[model samples]
Target: MSNPLRLVLFDVDGTLVDSQGSIVSAMTASFSALSLDAPSRDAILSIVGLSLPQAMQNLAPQQSVANQTRLVDEYKQAYHAQRLAQGAASSPLYPGARDVLEELHAQPETLLGVATGKSQRGLDALVEAHGLERFFITRQVADHHPSKPHPSMIQAALSETGVAEQHAVMIGDTRFDMDMAAAAGIASIGVSWGYHDVSALNSATAVIEDFAQLSPALAQLWDK
Candidate 1:
């Protein structure tokens, strides 16, 4: 196979799907199961891009490590149950996400990957549900790698896809994504439509307002 001109890694939650509702609801359920109050919506959103344990730790730093571990486990169970109750399609893809991915995937020189905080099981379900499994050739999830802001996920995707750090771009909605890209010595794009405020995306190489802007931005990045 010929070398890819670039590898594009995407974050699943705020970047592709509007999963705030499902996440908030699931976190609420997890807290309730422990007979504790759920964190506020803002608090939940703040940690959306981190792995479960990391997120739970930030949300309840006062809790014992044992309790934090329990919360993480409960959050998974509660999230799964909530997703089942809401039907398997609890979150919808952001408008134009499919089109943008389709267009990029068709570019023979570009490879697609996913570097997300979601577990592999969760990523599998999400991709299958959206029929987007075809677009990605590599997927790095929280189950197998350290959480965002860590370069493990990005580096793993680069290694698996045989794409050098210089030829990869990480697209996400949070500082975690940007920091990860920076740590991996790659570029990052932040989308404004996600849970995080635009100001938080200052670390990004580029911040796009919509999916339509992605193609042009990518083209510019590649040519630079």
Candidate 2:
């Protein structure tokens, strides 16, 4: 008999790729293009796992909706320009990320997917640059979902992969990811080296400090 298939979904930014430099730079440029003062680095990172519209709303609540729309446009343009300039160097994977992903991908009974706040264009660029297009079977992006904490992305991934909630896990670096998993009735694993503070990950089923701990963490989670 064959082992049952299990799906593991990952968040792109912060979790897999450390795109903080590009994120911060693009955000600053977006605000600057509109002659607006950008939010502080901490404030910007706080919304890292949200869709751009929701992120803009959070960062500039007092701004008119029109300005928020403009901010999103500017951000997309600036981020794309930066990506074109730097390619894969713009967002390097965290230490051991590729090795861990490779190990997971090699498992016959395991399937990998992505549930990210990034748009399809952005996600595509990152995946191509990193040569990770073959690793993930499903790619859920903010372009087609309601963003993290909404369960839309997770639900879609589960539906697409035909993986039961109990047999799937969401791995990310923010409460939004934890909350999304909880909403989707799946387990969540949080990483400490991401944008959110460790305390913010209290809702996660498991928390690990480095990529090396991921496999064990998954084992422990599934053992429950």
Candidate 3:
């Protein structure tokens, strides 16, 4: 019989790409445009995996819903403008990221997908730009479904891919990812190379320091 663990879900922003700096810059620019306080880098980094509106809410809790909406709009505008101006050059993959995905793709029993807070357009642009499209069979973008900490997106991935929760694993860089995976009743593997610190992802089933360690770490999963 085949191994039950057949599906591997990934989180995009921090896990697959180092987009923290670009994200922070865009957020800061948005705040500046609105004459609001730009959150510290640490504060923005802490909320990496949340949906845009949710992130805005977290960053500016005292603001009214209308204000939050305005912030999110401004943030997206600035982010898009920067991407266009710079040819979307921000956020390259971490070391060995491509190799890890290639290796994972080589496994016949394994299927890959993504669950990210980025909008579909943004995610598509990034995936295409990096030539990472071949690895992901399905992508669950933020606006396409419910945000992280909610099981809807993960559920969509599982349903679309025909992967069972017990036989799949979610890999990400935040507690939001872990929490979502746990809520979906699946195993989670966290990466330390992302926005969240190692301690933040400590609750994950496994924490990998880099993509080079991913294969062996995943192998150990089924060995247990």
Candidate 4:
């Protein structure tokens, strides 16, 4: 396992789990609570990787800042409440996600972790519910640092795992994820099965179709 990848940082939502329906439902509930128009499912799905504040900005740009704050607060509450009842049902992993992670975990030199916009509490719940807590050696949640496109979260994961930037790679389903990796001067692999399409992942060093492709992708990265 020498010369192996030191760290692999993952994005949670679209990359590992498909929580689109739950997200849209929660957004709708929040909008209803505020008497505002709920964004369409497709629209909500498009902003899956962003922080709640950022998502709110994209969904209701015309709304005043005060209103946006209020709406986002309501959205978080609704989402958390619904998640408590449904547990992992609302955010099931994509096919092969668990297997892929398990395979990655088998590598002695690789330290698996997450960099997500979800709050630490929310991320902990999801990981524990899905039995994924055992796989990650570290986790960088939203409140741990500034939002994505910022490298702080990734930086934190590297520092905690003792993995240098050059020895790490990021895997996610969005341009934001790729951008963040690029900003950190680390390689990134984008997945087509996530929220963003291929074109959106063009900036990534590699683009994979599914979890089965991840090992080969990492092999290629090592070759470089």
lDDT of 4 by residue, 65-99 (tens): 99899988998898899899999998999999999
The lowest-lDDT stretch of 10 consecutive residues in candidate 4 is 1-10
Point out the higher-scoring one by TM-score: 1 or 2: 2
Give TM-scores for every candidate, taking all chains together and pairing residue i with residue i. 0.96, 0.99, 0.96, 0.96
Highest lDDT, which number?
2
lDDT of each: 0.90, 0.95, 0.88, 0.89
lDDT of 4: 0.89
lDDT of 2: 0.95
Query: Between prediction 2 and prediction 4, which has the larger lDDT?
Result: 2
Misplaced by over 4 Å in model 4 are: none
81 Cα displacement, candidate 2 (Å): 0.3
Q: Mark the regions of model 2 whose C-alpha exceeds 4 Å error after superposition.
A: none
lDDT of 3 by residue, 100-209 (tens): 89998999889999999999888988888888878999899899777788988899999999988877889999999998999898889999888888887766999988
lDDT at position 74, candidate 2: 98
Report the backbone clash tally of model 4.
0
Clash count in backbone of candidate 3? 0
| Candidate 1 deviant stretches above 4 angstroms | 1-4
